[model samples]
Target: MDQPIWLTFIVAFILMNVLLVGMAYMTLFERKVLAAMQDRVGPNRSGRFGLLQPLADAVKLLGKEDLIPKHADKIIFYFAPLVIFVTAIVRVAVIPFGNQIEIGGQPVALFAADLNVGALFLLAFGSLGVYGIILGAYASANRYSLLGGLRAAAQVVSYEIILGLSLVGVFLLSGSLSVRQIMLQQSAELQVGPLTMPNWFILSQPLAFVLFMIAAVAETNRAPFDMPEAESELISGFHTEYSGFRFSFYFLGEYINMIIVSLFAATLFLGGVDGPGADRYWGLGVLWLVLKVTVFLFFYIWLRGTLPRFRYDQLMGIAWKVLLPLVLLNIIVTAFIRLIGNGQIF
Candidate 1:
């Protein structure tokens, strides 16, 4: 039986809400983890161990005065946040968060829309995110914001290419664009003496994972490569003209993008939603998936806590000179391996 049209809308709405909530608190989680890394208490004042901080922040944003600079283009300034927010929310469709259980004898896919070209869709949307920043920066009429937007556009353009190329190995092997298909493919070959590996993409494609991780970090403008939104230099970057919930939307979009990147990394390379006892117990898959995603998220937070921001020139050089070439070479090797496996001479 096919899912009803209304159900699809409902599911999309619910998942978007869930994504928003998760993104909101993900910031707190990052702070807490980073604090532990540095031997300091992250946040304990708002609520128990800062559990309520995200909520409190939400309240503050709602009650705060909305501001737009006198020089800013009010129309585009207003539109930018919505663009970023909507674009970020739409990409969650292809991700399978858990297993599907039979209900009423209908087999509903665990994910929203497991498109054949899911990975490519992610790349497209990720690049689109840069436009939100670009428009916001241009509309603000602030020199710093404009500069930040330019950096973001350039950074995302270069790194996103590297990011997309990094996943070509998975595309090559799975020969399917569906994310679930990729996970299923990894599951078949995961056996060892006494260890049962979840169908993680990491084992076969470590280089892809590494290159993808580095490019993802830069693409999201996270630490070490976060030249776009460097607080000291850009005065909070492209959204400087934005205030109140508008700024929150941009921040929320950034955080959501971060989670999306982490989830993609987990699903593509870390063998998404798989874990010990995956064969016998269905629940273990979720646990294993969470563990894998947490590892990536921890790495994200750790880098922020440990590394200093990179200069613009150095950041660009690393992406162009180092990451691009490495990812290209990885794809070359992967192609040759695939060709040899298929008994193709070239």
Candidate 2:
């Protein structure tokens, strides 16, 4: 059944606002996690454990002067951050938060959109974010910014291959590119001798899971793989010339991208909204999804706190020489196993 147009709009509006708020808090979350790991207090003075820190930061950024370098391309510099922010927001439309639930006598899907090619939709928008980084860097007209953009371009391109290939095994196993369907496929229970558990793709595709997580970290430009904005080297990378709210745009976009990736990984491998009682209670499914995404977010923070930045050559080498081949091998092995299970191979 088709959803009412107004309903879709309402859902989109709500989800977008939630994402914005979530993006703000994600900074606090990361800071707190990192602080705890480093034996320090983080943002506690703002609002009882720094609950108001994001707001304070937003207010400060808004009040600061928005600076543009003298040599910057005014037009592209103005447009680039929006490209990153908008693309990050757009990717959230396809992530399924939970199963459908009744609302005013009608069943409403817990997601914004349910396209058949939702996974590809996500990937396409994700890839477009690079344009923002590259354009922002070039528009800055600063040597450091330009170098950062160059590194971003190469890193994203290399890791994107591994990221995409890592998911091919999951796609093959579930026989669908729609994330919703893949989550549903994983909802079934699997029996392993005396144990029974949700048939999450991670169990069967452990290699893909590892590869996906690694590529995800790179794809989001998180630490260790955050070569683009290496402060020690590029002095803040692509957004080096941006200040005030303009810089905030890039910051918001990065956190939002992190959230989206965490959600995507959760859905793809952790059975998404799948957990005990999730089928019977949509709220439980939503909770499960949130919990899973939180774990991934913590993992992201953990890596940032623990791992040192990778050298430029090492970053590129790992993506091209290490992750790429492993993902390809995983795809081949998955395909073979699938064929055998389907009685198409001995």
Candidate 3:
């Protein structure tokens, strides 16, 4: 049964606020992790252990002057950041954070909408966000911004293929594209001789898992893969001329993308919301999802602190020459194995 209209609205409202707050603290989380890795204190002055740092940063950005280049295309420049930010937030609509739970004698689903083609929906919307970068760069009327936008277009085009292919194995193994269906399938236990374990796709599709992580990192333009915004070469890339709240929109969009991608990965491969006892308690399921996302978030921060940025050529080459082939191989192998298991081929 469908949830009440009012209930759905409430869930979406709560989810949106949670994501916004999470995106803000993600900055603080990254900084603290990087500081620990670099043997320095980070953001301890704002409020206890700098817990209030995100608020401080928000205030500072709000007070900064908004600037637009005199020669810039005002219309495109005005809407470009909105494109990125809105797409990032909308991508989370289909992600199932937990199973249905009872509320006031009625059952309520945990997601905004249960789309049958959730995976494709994510990929399609994710692809749209690049346009914001491209348009922002072009409208800025700056050579550096143009170069950054070009780099972004090329890099995203290359990695997006690998990212899509990497998920082929997961889709094959689960036999469904609905995020909730995939998570439910993973909740089953697999008996391998004397061993018993949750049947997460990560166990059966390790190659796909690795490929997905790499492609995901590139897709989000983080660390070594962040060629589009390479400060040294392109001077902050597409948004070079953006300032104040407009600039904050791009920054927030990136962090929100990271969170959404992390959550999506947890759902697809980590038995999202399926930890011990989650079956009985929906709240536990939500907690498990949060824990899984936290691990991925930490990995993202660790990469930034540990690895140097890749050269533009190396970034593009790895996506095309390396990840592309591996993901294809993983899909082929997965399909063959499934066929054998089903006795469809000798």
Best by lDDT: 2
In order, candidate lDDTs are 0.84, 0.92, 0.92
Question: 1-346, model 1: which lDDT tens digit per residue?
Answer: 2677676676677778878888877989998998888899988899788999999989999899998889888899889988887788888888776556555886555578778888888888988988889999999999999999999999999998899999998898778888877876766656777886755678878999899999999988889888888999888888877889999989988899988888888888877876557755656876677677777878888899899999899988998999888999989998899999899884
> Any idea what lDDT model 1 has?
0.84
Pairing residues by index, what is the TM-score of model 1?
0.94
Q: Report the lDDT tens digits of candidate 2 across residue range 1-346.
A: 4678788788889899999998999999999999999999888999888999999999999999999999999999999999999999999999998867888888787788889999999999999999999999999999999999999999998988888899999999999999899999999999999999889999999999999999989988999899999999899999889999999999989999999999999999999999989989888988999999899999999999999999999888888888888999999999999999999988
The global Cα lDDT (0 to 1) of model 3 is 0.92
Off by over 4 Å in 3: none
Candidate 2 Cα errors over 4 Å, as ranges = none
lDDT of 1 at 104: 82
Higher-ranked by TM-score: 1 or 2 = 2
What are the candidates' C-alpha RMSDs? 2.0, 0.8, 0.8
**In model 1, which runs have C-alpha deviations exceeding 4 angstroms?**
191-199, 279-283
Going through the candidates in order, what is the number of backbone clashes in each? 1, 0, 0
Clashes of 3: 0
Per-residue lDDT of model 3, residues 1-346, tens digit only: 4677998888888899999999999999999999999999988999999999999999999999999999999999999999999999998889998878888879998998889999989999888989889999999999999999999899888888988999999999888988889989999999989999999989999988898899889888899789889998888999899999999999988999999999999999999999999999988899999999999999999999999999888888888888888999999999999999999999
Worst 10 residues of 1 by lDDT: 101-110
Each candidate structure's TM-score, on Cα atoms with residue i matched to residue i, is 0.94, 0.99, 0.99
